[model samples]
Target: MSDNPKPTVEGGSDLPGWEWDRTVEDSEAVAVGDSVTFSKDITDDDVVRFAEASGDTNPLHLEDDYAAETRFGGRIAHGMLVGGLISAALARFPGTVVYLSQDFEFKGPVRIGDRATAEVEVADTLDGGRYQLSTQVLVDDEVVIDGEAIVLIDEAP
Candidate 1:
């Protein structure tokens, strides 16, 4: 599946009221140990929108009452939402990138209103225009999600 040029994503958000802090484009170069990042402020609005889109209405991610009784103590954001930030970071790559695979471990919960940063560094390279990246999402200096991804880069059309 990683070998395929196109994945299933059809578009990105152009919704009003939400904004990215920074947009990095046309970087110097991508080499081993180089990195890319994208950060966003997680809001209740973001959580609700994700739930509606993903059909993951687990109370742990929605109702405050239900989540307060659980280990998380309050409504928490979806783990995959954080992963999407990692995808956002990867999209900043110099060229078009198609995610081949991702391995993730959810180490901690992301509470509403928390600011999360996704950092991905080039760990190594494989044959046939592939790169292996070390991926991590941090919330206030704590590692919340960690993983690695294999991506295939295509020259821009």
Candidate 2:
């Protein structure tokens, strides 16, 4: 969400392999048809960093042997970690997007290294520049997470 054309890390270096797209060219004209999609590979580093940052060291997401014994049969990315992609999509909106709230139902597992894509579309425009959006994350065309979100899109200062 910085004014940079590409997402950057702490050093202002571009985040490798991260890509996004939006249907609306004029970010100022956000409407029901406005939509954005963000894609990136959920790497091993992503899982570990997320686990450390979120304090969700669930064995299913960290301990390979322990995960191997479970129904997933291997380590899977944390549900919230995958859900965070929705936030990524929202950040691409033209304005200074302020997240209001989000609800998610994780539908499947995303293994480390899976290319996860999150798509969000404006479903309705509310009063005061707020929007209700339909949100979902997919892996290989399979919906791994489904949900909705509300956000306030404010003008860039």
Candidate 3:
């Protein structure tokens, strides 16, 4: 748990229209306070793209009528699609981060158009250039995904 205030991003996106902001230096020594995060609004285009790429065409994610009959009562984004937000946050780490392992719990639904944020905080630094992090995704103030990850980081080649 860190008391550091969250960082903010200014104008400009690496990818047009997709806002990505990172405020950490990779060369900086790892510390418990270290963290990174990014956010984007989930869109119908996003869902369609993910569904097509992942081949996870479950009606809950692709068919509104089908989903409406379920507990969700409407279409919801794929849990993995939402989890990718966590990977997006991890990519912001100060070095080249390679995912070694991750654990997730899908606690809630992320609807299309909901602005989602992926946040990761350094919880422990292991020997051999590895780090354990607390991972989470949120829609507004609600925690939709909770998880942890272990990553191997190396200086950019």
Candidate 4:
């Protein structure tokens, strides 16, 4: 057998080998007020890809003409796709983390070509190893989504 493993995802690169560390614990108490922010330029390709991956093909998301007739005036991204960017922020930070729950409120429509940035802050620690994470998704400094996330982390024993 060849030494290389088959790529499991499209557009995947083969560089950077994976190493397994068995001793890492999976729980922690994230400090309150700690925050993480991340930004990405939204593109039509991004919207299409998210729609394909998420199976959300509402005309408001995929059809510009249909969207233009709506109150939003043009294609708007799926709210969950915008909220999902917060997961990128969390992943970029240090921790062994797992999502417990999310409460999202869509405040405004996100149109194509709008750069979306997500800011997440450690809100409060709850009982049973859960932490409340407050998140905001902004497009060009305009708040589009506001939400709270509950996550569990592995604290060192």
Candidate 5:
């Protein structure tokens, strides 16, 4: 992680539909040692829609009986579905963001009606203009999944 603290906007970067500018000079700041958390409740409809849209019809996420037989003992949401929300947050933040890679570790099952929170912390900065962010998804204060994401932001134009 590079220790340089200056924020600049790249013109004509690789990210599509994004114009990087220093509109929010502190947008990228991680407050030295603070973490940023974004949370939302998971509804049954959310799970069903995600399953339908992603074409992942795993019975464990839809069939209660089948899910009950599993270790979770109930239906759970698709891991990527919860992950997608984190991606959405990163994209909406004030910057030209590009997801480079992600490493996810599912800690527990995420059931419908559980309020999940996604937290991100600026972990490191690479020399190649990439940001390594520490991310996690939690339910009822229990971390359901955690991972690290690599994002690239270049000058727009």
Candidate 6:
């Protein structure tokens, strides 16, 4: 949302190889057009761990042979797993970001080992410290998921 982007925070994650950047310096200044980006690479361990945690052990995401036969041509990451990146982006916001609702359209497949970047932009200011954000996840500079989310940003207590 910011044309002149400034790095409010960089390499904010404690996890290895994870990174984030916030366009606005003040996280408490939740306004229309504020944006944040979070990036990480999807790895084999991530997929297996996500499957074990979420119970979404679909063969297309886990079985290379099965996935190769499908239209995707190879194993692909879970859609929701990639969508979760949007939440990762929101967490970089200046306050406690609570999600009320989110809706997503999976436009394309995200292969394992791809670097996924989630971008969240505050599209509109809502009543009661809430905001509507446009959320997107991209792999290789191609949008793989697009969505909208409503979140309540509460002051850090």
Better of 1 and 2 by lDDT: 2
- Model 5 lDDT-worst window of ten: 14-23
Model 4 ranges off by over 4 Å: 1-29, 155-157
Tens-digit lDDT track of model 6 for 1-157: 3333323445652467677888766657878988999899999899999999999999999999999999999999999899998988887787678999999999999999999999999999999999999999999899999999999998767
Q: With candidate 2 superimposed using the best TM-score fit, by how many Å does residue 142's alpha carbon deviate from the native?
A: 0.3
Candidate 5 segments exceeding 4 Å error: 1-35, 154-157
lDDT of 4 by residue, 1-157 (tens): 1132222235673223221111112235357776667676667887899989988899998997899999989898788888887876665445556798888888998877777888888889788766798988898788899999988766433
Q: Write the per-residue lDDT of candidate 2 for residues 1-157, one digit (tens) a residue.
A: 2343754579896577777888775556999978999899999999999999999999899999999999999999999999999998887887789999999898999999999999999999999889999999999999999999999998767
Name the regions of candidate 1 deviating beyond 4 angstroms.
Answer: 1-29
Q: What is the descending TM-score order?
A: 2, 6, 3, 1, 4, 5
Clashes of each: 0, 0, 1, 7, 7, 1
The residue-by-residue lDDT of candidate 1 on 112-154, one tens digit each, is 9898888888899787888899999999999999999998877
TM-score of each: 0.83, 0.93, 0.87, 0.76, 0.74, 0.90
RMSD of 6: 4.1
What are the lDDT figures for the candidates, one per model? 0.78, 0.89, 0.81, 0.71, 0.69, 0.87
Best by TM-score: 2
Q: Candidate 6: where are CA atoms >4 Å away?
A: 1-13
Q: Considering only N, C-alpha and C atoms within 3 Å, which residue pairs clash in candidate 4?
A: 26-154, 27-153, 27-154, 27-155, 28-153, 28-154, 28-155
**Model 2 CA lDDT for position 134:** 98
Give the number of colliding residue pairs in candidate 5.
7
For model 3, how does the per-residue alpha-carbon lDDT over 2-93 read when each residue is reduced to its tens digit? 23332334653244444444545753476676888778889899999999999999999999889999998899999999999888887766
The TM-score that candidate 2 achieves is 0.93
